[model samples]
Target chain A: MSLASLTKDWAATSYGFLDASAKRELRRKMLKAIAVPGCQMPYASREVPMARGWGTGGLQVTLTLVNPASTVKVIDQGADDGVNAASIRRFISRVSGAAETWDTLSASIVQSRHRVPEEVMREDQILVLQVPNPEPLRGVEPNMSIARQMHADADYGKLWLTLYEQIVRKGRIMQGAAYPSMVNGRHVMTPSPIPRWDVPKLNMAKHLTFLSAGREKRLFAVPPFTRVEPLVFSDRPYQVEEHAHLTCRRSGLSGYFMNEIPQDNGGSTFEVSDSNLGIKAIQKAEGAPTEIGETWYRDGEYSA
Target chain B: MLTVAPPDAIELRCNSTFQALMWALSRPGDARVMPEAGLAGIAETLVDLECTVFADTPDLREAVSASGALVTGDVSRADHVFLSSLENAADQIVQLRCGSPLYPDDGATLIVAARHAGQRLRLSGPGIEEPTEISLDAPPAFWAMRAMLCAYPEGFDCFFVDAGSVIGIPRSTKVEVL
Candidate 1:
């Protein structure tokens, strides 16, 4: 073949900020990640404008997936207005000519750091989580090669022992976020630093979730209707944060995950962690038309 | 303001093609429409210089080779395999790579052209909300060989294409001949 047949017309930059080769590599890895639900697939995490640890993994995945028709949303700790979230959202839209939305319901693809939306994600929508650490066994096993062997053997005893020690020392399970969860009965994965309250949203849920860690250079998936069981002893049941009774100081909504603000008086007030959900609640209260989708939690209880 | 390059036609086509493949593989047993009919788009979307691909057709092999991926004659050595028809390649089925437990990503992806209308099969796995049944035109030997070759967490993923419609069956899925 001649050079003309082999080469394309030169462009200033590749679409979505990633070269075609990078996207193809990611596409291959992503397919494998979905094939084995909750199993981390190693990828060449390509460089972006952002830092490696600061949501670059999620950004790459979004860039690979986004198109002009895609409605994109990015969130940092459940707030779309956060600088990190806002910038990522803008960059995606600017590069791809995609529509941007803070409302989870309006988004076709939701990329976030440390939170799933308060609204239930539909089967059609995709959720990409910015994972700081994709490996659930990293805490117990430092050597990655051996850890992969353990994963191959399906030997999760060390993970269980970590939980057991937590109970013995703290009188309860003290591990907060990035809880180790068993996915599809075979693989255990870190659900990406999301709070215990938000973990159940991924269990047998309608939406497909991709968890990617750029620094780690690995990505994994939790497909729709897959089992995501948090590791817990039968004697001590898995417990979520006790935030059901706390009300959001801004919107007066209760029974959802909250962010606590400590006061000078030594008491603390709580606000809804999902900022967009709180905004919608306030708008509805003011008689503005709004639609709040069904949440995983109902009245502070993990009902779904 | 920083000016960004708009997506060229190739980028847009590959992006949409990948989206279809992703959703198709994510939700097995359900049919997803591809940007174009046939497996060429898939090769362009996924296979690159880093990959070793095996294709039954010379046209597809040439297309894959043009992408800079190594064209392998052996199915076992291929990370991606494209077959014009599964019924014609029964002997090649067992040779497909089913990656070991330590690294399941080494498992190959098989894209075969098959009719959507034929013998019914039941699928249940990560993607299926409940047990869903669909029909495919795969031969019985194909099913028997697939079941024998695949071991959970260590099996090749397959995509059945019919014209513009595609259905993915990951190794995680259990296919029961009905």
Candidate 2:
């Protein structure tokens, strides 16, 4: 079916247990978050049958933002069927029964993972991110009192010391994941682990962005035209990973990131696979002539 | 990606996922999300962006084909990248195909799954009004590598996914050592 019709169908679904009044309340709360921009506002986030880490925050926002005029696409790790994504899609389908898809561009409401879709999202789209921990200071001090005071006063000289310590003690900077960032030139906000590639996408985008944590029960927003800066030390320097070679193994494709597969005798090395929706390419390359939902695997896990 | 845990390793994934969520939410600028597979997941994780998890897409046969029609490719250009552990994050940082200066945001988002959230940097930036610290229990090998990847305007974004939640730190913000 055409995307337009599919989207039309998707909007018909309900937005979970939220009544019309509740939805309006959520809408009002979200607008409040957006209007203030960069401030955390606690909302009445519901506990879905799904777990805390499985996008309860995003689903709530989707319900609040979704309307008869929207098309929703939900993905986990950029793929629509990555368990969590499937759960959300199924939930929306069950409640709202709105047309659901993996297509990025076609979606007006998208709940995604650390990685954003390959298709660039437009301003019209509202991206909702799922969050677990909302505090950057938790790891640093382990004391909420200290952390709250640190932020209340902007006393981050220790962050520099930590990086310096990495360089001093080990000749390097010492952070791996959950790297810190400064949001809207004032408040530092988590960009919802949407991959570094997607991280920069948040820079100067036309769309309004929202982040929520059902478990934490905190919500924040990045209004249009706001500056989001990732944390960095001048002497240490900020850097993103670059590929020595970009090639996928299974599909014999290039211009795509490769997942290193073991290539040795007993073990192997790094290889690559399609990131998302490569079926179109696969069918063409292998003459596998197929369409969506046609399961052809020998292992027989998929039966669509 | 090879999975040591069963395909049903949902609980373990849950534990690490919360770690990941913390990092992602704490560090607005970083990327943290790991696949169920170990190293295989790490190396091939970025492929998730351009790849699909069809009911049968991982049919090893469908995966290894060169059709580009169903699902197949090289590991150079994916934006949604994955890593086996936060252990390999340092190297992944230097080699993950982060986008150019013009499209810096186009850099691949790397997912590094680890055994646990290690205690490491005390990160303070705009996210923390006063100050904030992040503890990563990534293996010492990870700590042994070049620690800092965040540089103003250029750096690999990261997501540290553990069992419970996720955490992130992109390359755009400034970090201070506590």
Candidate 3:
């Protein structure tokens, strides 16, 4: 083959901020990740402008999937206006020319950290979660090689033991976020530090979820309709963060997950953690034309 | 302000092709339309110098080689295998790489040319909300062979291409002949 055939014309920067070969590599790994649901697949984890731990994995996946036609949304800790979320959203839109949106219903791809949207995601939408640690066995087993062997053997007894110990000591399961969940009845995965309330939203849901850890250089997926059962005992049922009775002080919306603001008067007030949902509710109350999609929870109950 | 670089023709094609392939694999048994009507677009979208591909047809082999991938005659060594047809592929199917449990990503991705109509098969697994039935040109023997070879996380994934349409059945999918 001629040398000219091997090379392409020079350009300042590659489209979507990632070279074609990088995207191709990610595509291969992503397909494999989906093929074996919740099984971690190792990738090159190429460097981007941002640091490795701060949503780099999600950014890479987003960049690979983004195009001019895509509408992108980025959220940090369930808030679209967080510094990290806003920066990522703007960066993706700036590099790929994709439209940015805060509303979950309108986004084609949502790159999130620590939370799934309160609204039910459709089949067409993809959720890319920024994972700080993808391994569910890390807390119990420090060594990764043995941990991988345990995963191969589907041995998750230590995780259950830890939960049992917590129950014996605290009288309840103390695990708050990033609960270890069994996917497709085989692999146990950390759903990426999302709250207990949000974890149920992933169980047999319509959307495809990708949990990627850039620093760890691993990625996994939970395909639509896949079972994501949180580890719980037979006697004690799984408990969400008791935010069902809490109400958002600003929007007057209640029954969703809330963020508590500590007051100097030895009390705390609650606001909806999903900032866009509160904004939409306030706008609708103000008589502005706004559309709020159906949520997964209703009347402080996990309905969907 | 810096002006964003627009996507080139190849970028657009690969993007759309991957989108179709991604959604197809995400929801197994669903037919997704591709931008182009052949295996060539898929090769361009997935394989590169990092991959070893096995293509049954000489035309597809040449196309894969042009993309700088190591085109191989041995199916077991290939991470991606493209078959123009699956008429008498018993031996090849047996030799297809189903990766080890430790590193399941090493499993091969089998892409074959097959019609979307024929014998009905039921698919149920991670992707399917309910057990869905669809017709494919592959024989029942093929499904039986697949069931014998695949052992969940350690089996190969597949893509069946027909003109501009493609359907993906991942290793996680359980396919039953009707």
Q: Against the hidden true structure, what lDDT does model 1 obtain?
A: 0.93
For every model in order, the fraction of real contacts preserved is: 0.88, 0.00, 0.81
Instruction: Name the regions of candidate 2 deviating beyond 4 angstroms.
Output: A1-15, A169-171, A251-274, A280-304, B1-178
Number of the top candidate by DockQ?
3
Please write out the lDDT profile of model 1 over residues A97-156, one tens digit for every residue: 899999999999999999999899999899999999988899889999999999999999
Chain A TM-score by candidate, in order: 0.99, 0.77, 0.99
Quote the lDDT for B70 in model 3.
99
Candidate 3 regions exceeding 4 Å error are: none
lDDT of 3 by residue, B31-113 (tens): 99999999999999999999999999889999999999999889999999999888998778888999987888889999999
Ranking by TM-score: 3, 1, 2
Give lDDT tens digits, candidate 2, residues B28-118.
Answer: 4344554453333222212222232111124432332221223323234444445544543454445455444322344444555544434
Clashing pairs in 3: none
Q: Is candidate 1 or candidate 2 better by TM-score?
A: 1
**Once model 1 is optimally superposed onto the true structure by TM-score, how far is the C-alpha of residue A133 displaced, in angstroms?**
1.1
Candidate 2: tens digits of C-alpha lDDT, residues A80-170: 7677788787676555445676666567777776655544566457678777766666657898667655654556666656657777887
TM-score of each: 0.99, 0.53, 0.99
For candidate 3, give the lDDT of residue A93.
Answer: 94
Question: What is the C-alpha DockQ of each candidate?
Answer: 0.85, 0.01, 0.87
- The local distance difference test score of each candidate is 0.93, 0.51, 0.94
Error of 3 at B131 (Å): 0.9
